[model samples]
Target chain A: MIIGEQKPLDEIQGLLEDAEKVLVVGCGTCVTVCFAGGSREAQILSSSLRMSSKLNGHPQDVSDVTVQRQCEWEYLDEIEKEVAEADIILSLACGIGVQAMAKHFPEKWVVPGLNTTFLGIPVEQGIWEERCAACGDCVLGLTGGICPIARCSKSLLNGPCGGSEDGHCEIDPDIPCAWQLIYDRLTAMGREDNLLELQPPKNWQVSRDGGPRKIIREDLRLISDELES
Target chain B: MSGKDNGYLVGSHLEKMLRAGHFAVTGELGPPQSADPAVIHEKAALLKGYVDAVNITDNQTAIVRMSSIGAGTLVLQDGLEPVIQMTCRDRNRLAIQADLLGAYALGLRNLLCLTGDHQIFGNHPTAKNVYDMDSLQMVQMVTDMRDKAIFQCGDEFKGQTAKFLVGAAAAPFADPTPFRPLRLAKKVKAGANFIQTQLIYDIEAFAAYMEKVRELGLHEKAYILAGVGPLKSPGMAKYMKKNVPGILVPDEVIDRMLEAGKEWAGKKAADLSPEEKKARSKAWQTEGIQVCIDLIKEIQKIEGVAGIHIMAIEWEKAVKPIVEGAGLYPRPEVN
Candidate 1:
């Protein structure tokens, strides 16, 4: 899931400075699961902003609404009235949601209240770890299901560098060395021969290096002319 | 494609030393943090005529320093062979290959490919690292440049290709110690002409690792130059034992360093005079070199060991003494 964290209250307040009306729009998906930009957080933030503004002699009217999914236009359509009424629309969602709101309401100012961090899963209660780099090409089959592109500190492909020690990375003792994990799994499976072969230089062009990626499934798209009347 | 073209890859003295069946002794020369040619010249002078070659480091430990290529030119001017280190943390493939061409044009024949220390460990913690290619792929890319005359992108260039006696580093005692030898085999298969390992403080562990390496017969594929460094003081030994991973420093070695300071043992700092302090430092250094010398002798006995790579980290003065003490002086001429 796309995890995110709320920005500091002071920074968020600063971004909304001098605005006469503010709308705190929250998302009900990934951000909600992370407890960052859910409806409750938006309501709490709205109350705090109102109190802080009143104390500073500029009490701006604040309001909030939660949408099912902020990334899609259909979900954002439900909050058109709220967005049109506010001078500033603060999005309490991941980066994608904030951009969607801005695109949907092109004339209004939209700012992100949360920072989208990574594509990861919570390994334990209240703990999240990144699991994928979203690199277009995946080599999980060869590497024992662990992603070196996301796990290794250096993302080393061939093997662990000199910095790996005690099954941990040199960057931080907390981060497990990706290659060591891959080695262990592969060895246990008697697939150690896979590692002996050199992994050629990664084709980064398939990744972000090829620039903003897009997928066009010709079969999935329906031309308007072909749609039934 | 392991130098089958013959006539030597770069004909570097270090390469010739290995090719000539001589026990090579390579030294390290750390570039200064500033652009000072004198520092390079001074360090190279200390190592000149004492070892087969001098390795120029590329901002080792993430600390910014004068470039290895720039410093290596000075070492070359001072009548020494330099194995300029190129790390992947700072440059992408284009930048690395470009630098290799330029370094080769400047008479540098040896190259040590590395997956540079992470930026978090260096002075610039906020800097982004560019591990565009790991050390293994780097070795293959460089060898391809020399043997196949193609760039990492598989694009053939139209000029004299950058030919180098490609080298890579090995860390013998890193975790999953059992897999370290297999990792070394990958380097050999990647076309590395020589392998300079990380500092080896625990010989028994390194010997066992070498036994695994020997079982695979990797020693016959590439020259394995064991890395050895003199512990500057007991504090250094303790710090390395605690902080640096993959470096195994036995208690006995640390005890030797501690024993060197026995003269001032149990004395309060307030009671010790400046002269006594100086004397203690000198005593520790002498022991450090002696211990390094002793390690070289023990490492020499290991069957598959080809030579030793002495990294007198920031202690150039110790190189000559360690080399002489190890009976590695007058590095055999390989003409």
Candidate 2:
């Protein structure tokens, strides 16, 4: 899942400074699970902005609404009315949600209120750690399920760099060294032979380097009138 | 590809020494946290002729410092060869390539591609990590720049591409130690010409690692420099054993340090004054240097070992003595 955190109140306030009508939109998916830009967070931010703006002697109108999942156009369509009513749409969702909202409502000025961080999942309550780099390729089978691209400080395919000490990364004592974990996991699984083979250079063209990627499942595509004709 | 195809930059004495099979000796210098060129020059000058090359670390341990390129340039000015250490923690490929070009233009040749220490380990725990590519990719990219005159993205270099006697790091003691040599082989295949390993307090473990490296015939592909460092004190040993990851400062070394302070240890812990404590620390530090010198000697006899990389962290002054004691001084004057 994508993890993100709301921008600081002052930065958001600065971005929304000139607006008289502000519409705060939230996402119910990843941001909700991470307790970031979800519905509750949007409401709290709306109230805080109202109180702060009122304190600053220029009270602005604020409205809050949440889409089921802001990344999907169908879910985002539910908030078209609220978005059209506001002077600006402040998306309290991941960066993708902001872009999706902007794409759906091309007229309104859509701004991101959160900084999208990484693709991660909750490691524990109140703690989330990155788990994937979405490198357009995966090597988990060879690495004992630990994603070196996401976890190793260097994303080294064949490491445990010299900095990895005691199963933790040299960068931080708390963050477990991804390579160390891979080595341990591979040893336990008795698949140590998998690591001996050198992984070839990653083809970045399949990753973001190739430019924005899209998935097309021709088999799953609906046959519209134009296609049928 | 062989080292010849690796396209080593001109005038790297370390490369010259390694290629000449003269038991290359290298040293590490962590550019100060502050931006003082004089400090860099002074520290580098300490190891000026003692070691073949000096490694200028890039924000090692994630602490912000004068950039490694900046410090390495100063090292060059001091008439010492500088191995510019580049980490993947802070820069994307564009910035990394740009910096490498800048470093090469400034007459620095040797480059140690590292996956830098995580930001969380440094003062800036909240800083976003920009691991655009891991060190493996970094090495491969450098190799491409040197060998093919092309970027990893397949764009041809306009002109005058940077050539480097590329290097990378190793952790012989990292857990699942059996696989460590295999990891080293991968780095070598990725284009590392030399490898400076993490601190080796356990010579037995390192010897075992070297055995695997030799068995796989990786030693023929890359120069393997065993990293050895002087411990400042028993407290320092304990701190590293507790905090620093991958480094195994064997309990025996710590026991030696404790023995160094037996005079002070016999008294009440609170009875010792600051000066007394400093004296005890001095004793431990002296013993630490002796131990490092001994380790270097033992490592020199190990099969597949190229040389020693003495990391006298912040104690650059101790580098010369350790090298002399270990009989690594009078570094070969490579053409």
Candidate 3:
């Protein structure tokens, strides 16, 4: 799950403070799972804004709608009619959803309701810890399923940093040393030999450091000549 | 002023009397999941004249609940004082400010600001958790609203200034590692007029907690409402023990409940049948109500404790009986 937290109520309200007609759009994907953008949260926010607008004596016409996946074009198409009516779009989705909304409706103002935090999972009921960095590479297979890119405060792939002590990160005692956890998991799996393999320095070029990435499959392409009449 | 003059007493006087050892009763009402006025009115009416004030829960447990403003409005319309429970889960500062304005407009006066339960605890586990501002910031937000009619985000309102009897929550037992009273004192400094604590079972420990609150001189600055809940069943006791954070369950209380069962008595200490165990669990649940009431009586005697917030949890009907059984009566004027 993409674990995200909602922006402060005051911050979100400030984003749409000047709007007369506010449309809150929710996404039903990673953000929804993280509790940031979902139908329920969207409605609660809409009602809150409406109530606040009333309280301020500057009543707003607040409407709420949820797209199956705000990051997808097809899902955003559903809100074209509603988007035209809104003075401001308060997206309760994550960063991707907000960008997608802005992409589809370039002329309309869009504000984010959530602070995109991290790709994580619920460790237990009511607790979510970051677990992935989406570093544009696959390295977990060599690290006992723990992503050093996400958990190692410094994203060190080779070994524990000097700050690790007593299997706890020096920066935060609450955080377990990611390398230690990886070592223990690997040791339990009888794959301790993998630790001896010195990892090459990460290639930042293949990841986000390179220009925006793209993929092309010639087999999936349609011929333009055949499309023309 | 005599109690007969005005039905609704300002929370300050009530807290003073409560700290002086007068028993106090409070109740909670979970808002429904919609904007319909009738449902909100119905629930508020059920609690009217029974509870000192009906708590309008704000997106409790991150579940989709009605806005506190609407529910508080309904309670006010019904001639009952509404304690608006504002959570930092949903709104940013702008929305919080806006709601405070709306709440004052609706004539709702009391406020309980909470750093809400995370989303994973609710039905929608994937929901985004918002803690941009914690409970202390929320208290400051409301106080700012009341003091300047300006939101944290600089939005100005030309209306009657809000005067909320602000409250916050603390768990003395949960974060035992920290200085809990010190943390609570910070909330008081942030403009918390009172505090409604997490559910407490151990009076002796709570009394000790009260002494700490007194040491900080918080007893002079803020009212403290000790939270209490009557376990409806043995299953509920187990659920509370496992699920509710910051709550402690004394083993002796559970053992006493188990001992009260008819099937358990005269049966050998060893070798109890499965059927006997199930029957005993049922009997224990039946005895839990009385146990909680007795606990409340003991809690009322604790110094520096202002009142009790009875969280019946969908059992609002039993509130009157529990309050009466605990040797408390609604102020005559309120009735």
Candidate 4:
């Protein structure tokens, strides 16, 4: 659950004040679980915009449609008919969903309805917090399932930096020291020896630093050129 | 009286009672996103004579539904008071205030100001939010409209004066710090005449909450309608306990339902194979009805409870029975 808060309605209205025919689109993925943008949100926004427009006497023809997953091409295909009719597409998905909507419907203008916040989980009902960073690496085996990249202010790979005081981060007292939590968990599991092992600095090449990344599976690949020809 | 003036007076009286100690009941119905209005109309009709007012939720929880204004107009056309739920998740104050005025013109008198659920929780995650003003400020704006007949911090209204039964929501268990009562007070001071709280299950905790409300002098200031939604099934009970925010489901209530389960002997029937289906069906129906009646009874006992807002959702037909079972009758004269 990537925890995030909805942006104010006025800010969203401001972005598309000029749009005549508005299409409020929602994603059915990460942002939906986090309560930011999903099909439900898209519909709400579409209704709100329509009502707001009528109230203001600007009266734009506002419509709504939701894609199964805005991040994928297949889901975006479902709303191509609706997208074609609208002047602007207001996406209620996360950053990925919004970008995907933009990419799939290049002819229509796409506007984001939610502020993409952080990768987190609903720790309790109605409360969500950050949990992952998708740093393109997994060190949970060594750190007892906590990712320092997200919890640690410094994203320190080796260990806690000098900024840690009494097992709490110096930047914010409310935040627990990520390394301390890791240390405690490891010690509890009787794997304290794991921390003593020297680990090299994480290589950024495999992450977003390497630009757009792609994964290919030989078994899943389709031999299209020969068949199409 | 003009149809418009009658609507205004109805709204005004409701607002006055809301400011007083009178309990209020309000229910919500979502409008279809499309032009079809039959479903919205039918639901509004069923709730018309029962509730103090019906709320046509704009985009509750950010899920798209029918247009609230259109629904409000339909409700008004049917001679029922409609509480227009306006969320700031999709509009600025300029638009919000404008809608207030537009709703007023449409003969829609009641308004429930909300900040709206984050779009992320709905079907959309990447949607931009517009929080130009929160629910508090919106309440204040409505109050200002009533008193000055003008926009807050702006010029006077050039047209007929607009009045609204302004209300806001409070979630007692929403925050760890329990800011609901204090926030309710703030909304009152800002011009909120009534507060509709989130669904509550623990009467003891709610009674304790009322004690705090009395201490804060909010009991005397604004109408506080305890929100109650009947748990139709054991699954609903579990969902409310685990998922719904600011809800406190007591262990005793769960135990009672479980006991009811035993009396039906569904577990034993399940072992018999042939009786399993019948037993399962009987258990679900019995438990659902029992939970509904139990919640209403508990809520009726709480002090300082001005009234109860029963949210039956698609189960509007069960509302009358629940209210009657809880020993409440429609106070047609009150409204």
The best candidate by DockQ is 1
DockQ (Cα-based) for each candidate: 0.81, 0.40, 0.02, 0.02
**Model 1 CA deviation exceeding 4 Å by range:** A224-229, B1-6, B267-271
- Candidate 4 lDDT tens digits, A93-207: 8888878888888887888888888878887888776778787877888899988777875565544533344557655667787877886787789986665554433554576
> What's the true lDDT of residue B56 in model 4?
82
The chain B TM-scores of all candidates, as shown, are 0.97, 0.95, 0.84, 0.86
lDDT at A143 for candidate 2?
A: 91
TM-score of chain B of 3: 0.84
lDDT of 3 by residue, B62-88 (tens): 788878788777777787777889876
Per-model TM-score (chain A alone) = 0.95, 0.95, 0.91, 0.88
Reference-based lDDT, each prediction: 0.91, 0.86, 0.74, 0.72
Off by over 4 Å in 3: A1-229, B1-22, B34-42, B154-157, B260-286, B332-335
Error of 4 at B111 (Å): 0.8
Model 4 CA lDDT for position A102: 84
Question: How do all the candidates rank in terms of TM-score, highest first?
Answer: 1, 2, 4, 3
Q: Is the docking of candidate 4 incorrect, acceptable, medium or high quality?
A: incorrect
For each candidate in turn, the interface RMSD (Å) is 0.8, 2.6, 16.4, 19.0
* Per-residue lDDT of model 2, residues A70-141, tens digit only: 989999878778988999999988888899998999999998899999999898999989999899888887
